[model samples]
Target: MADPLALTPKSSYAELPLRIVSAILIAPPAVAAIWLGTPYIEMVVLAAVFMMAVEWARLVGHDRNPWLIGAMTAGAPQPVIGYFFGGFDIAAILTAILFLAMLVMAKIAKLPRGLWLAAGIPVIVLPAISLLFIRNDPMGVQTALWLVAVIAATDIGAYFSGRTIGGPKLAPRISPKKTWAGLIGGMLSAALVGTATILLIGEGDIPLIAVVSAIMAVVAQMGDLSESAVKRHFGVKDSGAIIPGHGGLFDRLDGFITSLPTIALATALSGASVLQWH
Candidate 1:
């Protein structure tokens, strides 16, 4: 059996330049995510989430029900969307209701029967909901930028770190490509990004932001691993070959799903500078 982490062109070096190019392409939207304000950012993010849900459903062997994916992505992001159109309470309640209703539907749906449906609901909601906390914060836009920076750092750091170090596997069962060295490399990368942002970026709570970024890095990797587990269970590789180098939107956003919720919760609980309370 060939090593999964043998630095293949298709999976490794080939992706380096593409990833750099992708970063260059992505920077504008990411900047806009903050400069453009919460509503527009939320809208784009929700749209991406909707698309990912549809792709994820197909990848998970649920070819019979495309509408379920539609319902999930549409309904899940409704709460976040509601915040822009209505208010936070309304948006949260609507999404919660939709989730509850979906829970019942998932239980009742006798076809294929699995926990993923239930899991998917929260996975969709958490990141969207996290945005609310982010939007409400005084440093919301900066916070959003920092959050994105942390995840990006992890991705970039892990790639180089893993490639350079190349040691033991992290979780070979779920993600054969991941290595322990890579995990550490990713975390350290996030830490460096966090520290740099804190020292250089003229925004956010330095210590708090660094801590949050570090935590998010781990969570992001966990999210990636979780998504990998889901894909493995379904015997699929890449949610979809949508991006030239990247797999799919779901594959791209997997880390964000985990990191966003953690950032939201931390911001809410810590009374961090990220949030402005009256």
Candidate 2:
């Protein structure tokens, strides 16, 4: 591991404040949507689905094909949106069809990154579905808030600590800016968030909540690293320039991309709200 005190690059510091400001702007709207539930949250998911799908498609396939590549990814969101009114069977069918169709289209087009292009479907769709899943829970709004807090805390903690601690890189090949200290800091931060959440609820096992949040921090980092790896593979810097400071929807929401699906699955399997860590 690189020494924790070692100073790193200066570029991050230059953009740090802008990043924070941008996040502040985006958070309230998202939180409101999550709190409102039904059509409101559905609209947020749809917007995210559109942006993230376009960004992913643009990244992997648009190098040469541009609009056509983006068009191919359009089918993914339909199934997720269908789940809101049409139920799971409709969603499953659309997802399978789109998933296979992307690959087939890529193969026909002889795209070098056919796999990557097809991956955009799951990458974009699953989380939208998961967001809906969480939102539909009786305790949905609170659960979503807790999940978002955990992810945001992880990202914020990691961003600052990685710069401040300047330690050995975590997955340097995938994301050179990430550090072991940042990972630890993020886990610790999320653990704190979890503890605070339990306290605010006025009950629950603190240590368990802390541990789960820490694990989720790791998951969010994994999502961040995975997005970085994809960008690296494509030789692209930032997914898109949509957000002034945050790159694109994908760049900002990558943690949610992975964490949502995982948490949703956990909720399904455990028969419990994520907020109820106890």
Q: What TM-scores do the predictions have?
A: 0.84, 0.92
Worst 10 residues of 2 by lDDT: 1-10
lDDT of 2 at 260: 91
Q: What C-alpha lDDT, on a 0 to 100 scale, does residue 77 get in candidate 2?
A: 74
Worst 10 residues of 1 by lDDT: 1-10
Candidate 1 structure quality by residue, lDDT tens digits, 124-194: 76686676567578777767877787888888777876777677778889887777777777777777787
Candidate 1 error regions (>4 Å):
1-12, 24-27, 85-88, 107-109, 202-212, 274-278
The clash numbers for all candidates, in the given order, read 0, 1
Q: How accurate is candidate 1 locally (lDDT)?
A: 0.69
| Candidate 2 CA-lDDT value | 0.78
